[model samples]
Target chain A: MTLLERDPKSPLTWSGNLPVTSRYTFGLAGEKFFRAIKDEGKIIGSYCKKCDHTYVPASQFCEKCLAEVSDWVDVGTIGELHTFTVLYEGYDGARLVQPEIVAFISLGDGGLIHRLGEINLDEIYFGMPLEAVFLPEGQRQGSILDIRYFKPAG
Target chain B: MTMRKVAVIGAGMTKFVRRAQETPKELSWLATRMALESCELTLDDIEAVCMGTAPDSFDGIHMKGEYLSDGAGAWRKPYMRSYVGGGTGVFVPIQGWYHVASGMFDVVLVVAEEKMSNFYPHAQAAFLTIFDHTTERPLGPNLLWIFALEMNRYMTTYGISKEDIARVSVQHKRNAANHPCALLGDPDITVEDVLNSEVLAYPVQRYDVSPVSDGAVAIVLAAEHVAKRLTDKPVWVEGVGWNLDTAHWTNRDLVYPRYVEYAARMAYDMAGIKEPKKEIHIAEPYDPFDYKALHHLEGLQLAERGQAPQLYIDGTAARDGNMPVCPSGGLLGVGNPIAAAGLMKIAELFWQLRGEAGDRQVPGQPRRGIAQAWGDLMQVGTVVIMGR
Candidate 1:
């Protein structure tokens, strides 16, 4: 039956009019990017001389300064926690049995905001220091999940 | 030094909801019909059409302007679409101002709509895409994170508290209680209640943010000559201004909207409004989030920064207050349908100035009012000042 012919009161729904798109990634390039962090325990950033801005989660262009970033900077593993929240409600398809703390951590030059791992909620505070922990090389996916969140600074 | 006047002769809208069962085209058609009917004009009477939607991705329809032509009654008509995220709703009307001010079209129809529910699983994830796609999105930050960061800075720098900011939400939503189309109006709530609400980010709670709604709104503008002939009491669009800021949102301080201030100053200069706080009777300063109302209040120079929340506590920003803000319940209560929400603010100002707002009318006679919308990662400011 045609979409309009179906009963409007029925619970069944379709995405006929709505549009959808998927993402694509290169095999070797994606692998190398992920494997570096997993095996070497290093953090990567892209630097642009035209804009003079460094970005985490690395990028090809300096959006504001509008210059291409050809140089890579090694971000120090330790940083300070600017602010954080322990989310009680499930979000974006991930349901956690226990709530998770997503934090905004400030590096020396810039900062990276990400989820925290293996940390007690009560132990966290504003301005607290933390460090990144890379995933084991064998289990690396070459994606953002490389560091798997940061840990408390000693 | 010069004057350019435009008038809104037509209006249209769609039934607002949490999720639209109709397609994007159908939604546009619904609002377009209502706006045309209000103006006592048919689609044929419209000289041109200007469309506004928050983001191409929110509706999951890229190049949505072309797809929505049939519903907006733009078939074979000059059509254009522009967006400024949350600011698109108000920007649509500003675009209409140009259409008439430049003498390009005598009658221009402005339409704004959004169907946020289409981004299923999580609309907040849609916000993840709004950040630096590669730099910020990988962090899995939600939309509220940016607001939270800004709110935190506002609070820390100005010494504002959660309760102080919460008062604006309480007052605005309470004012919305009388609004005809208010979606989340509640009078019984107190500042304590807002403070107690779940902390999504450090300072932004659920109540602090505008609800995700599915709806559409439209308004028709006519040049002075045609507008004077169409209606005996046409609200004059005395001035309009829109400006965009750098996308480097992180570099700037979010305590106040600098771009909004620049845009408002430009409009006020054109409208000959030397004193907005005293001359303007009514206002709708984009309240997509409750704190935003206060932020924009300061940005528009309605009140001094860090003083807006105190104004709310003093009942000065209420419906019958000295200078009422968001009398139509705003996005918090009235429902935010993206682009449509800003147009709705313009319509509300139109109704108030014409003395046509039945139930949501302010206490005394109001001569002039201003409506402003901010969007595009808080980069764009669209301001319109209207007078009777």
Candidate 2:
């Protein structure tokens, strides 16, 4: 019998993760950005004079001007919350004991997306002043986690 | 409306290697800089950007095009990413062609990048997701196994021999010796070496397959008026076409690639060429696998059905011969970084047509060339024809 003429029967099914693992290098700008956070406990941004803009999280080029940005500056720890969301469930839909507040904090011309701490979810509001809290020295790794979380500025 | 003519003004590529120390974004930037520099144009001169990358699985990054936009010099400009498995490389220039032919953009940047090494252990694992979950994934079939089946079918159907196919690998690798960026260019390679190589699957030996690679290629495309100002030796884009068959690869005959023919026909129609074998001066058929080069040549109607092997045997496909195939060393000799490999062919044709390919340039100053790329369960074909 032809493939199209085959009789209908029980359908077949299969499920599995793609048999692949990945190891990504923190890119050129990322390596420098993370190193500064880990070694110096600093927040830095790449400044582009052509566009007169500074990009947080550091970047190799300015998106607006398409020019290489070599001038990196300390963006400082204090920032204003541009947006926030409270998550009560984990990625797999599991309930959390305490809801986590995530927010985008504006720094330089760009911003950072991280978790908010030291403030109740009800008290979290847009444009709220916040400061990054870095992990204790020696406990810091060259990662975004180097900044443990953002909290209300004193 | 009359389609505005488009021309390739400049081309650039990173070395095809087993692994790249640079990130995908950095690789994209390097190629972008080289291409823009080749044309003496900057990002400010580019009006739009077209990016082609295959399988986010290989790079281990989702939305890879968006992540690579800035490096491709897309910053604050109209940008888009196009994909069709391996066909993406060739399709990207086609995408750029329309952007100019449509008159929406006067100058466009086309970039294709692939970093297969990011997939740990073996990049073959990433290809697992490309299979149908219910019908094929359960079979656990890798690309080599399926391609072996196609290779076996082609041989049996045409009464072809292993030695005849091995010659393609030998020829391409030897040709690659002249390519500065080639990863596997072996000048003294022999057909016997291919025949004796380790067999990954029956009939598919180690030498038969293209290496997994990391690389990026970029080209600048401009409308006729802008191309005249950019460079005097602009290679005009004569035609472009692409076609995809059903994902049910099992349902189709494995002996020949019909989709490639359809796509080639579409391109020939647009280019106003009635005889591809006569009109196409240089043919860079995809050679990720040696037999694939021959397979695509037949599909592109450059050779008779099941008779492509004769081209290599008769010296007609040699770099100095009548139709120099894969003088850029092809994916077999250079490296197969998926999407970038496809765009590499476009770059090859651009250099060849402009008589600027250096040591790898073909003789007699060939005026027109055709590049074809095949991918996706062996179901899609992308073809581009360019000429001076």
**Per-candidate interface C-alpha RMSD?**
6.2, 23.1
Superposed on all Cα atoms, model 1 deviates from the true structure by an RMSD in Å of: 4.7
| Model 1: per-residue Cα lDDT at residue B159 | 84
Identify the CAPRI category of the predicted complex in candidate 2. Answer: incorrect
Candidate 1 residues B186-284, lDDT tens each?
A: 878787888877666556777787777788888889988898888998998888888888665654546778899999999999888888899888889
TM-score of each prediction: 0.85, 0.72
Report the number of backbone clashes for model 2.
0
lDDT for A56 in candidate 2 is 82
CAPRI grade of model 1: incorrect
Model 2 C-alpha lDDT per residue in residues A39-83, reported as the tens digit of each score: 999889999998887878688887666788999999999998765
The window of 10 residues in a row where model 1 chain B has the poorest summed lDDT is B132-141
Which run of 10 residues does model 2 chain A get worst, by summed lDDT? A1-10
Scored by TM against the true chain B, the candidates give 0.96, 0.99
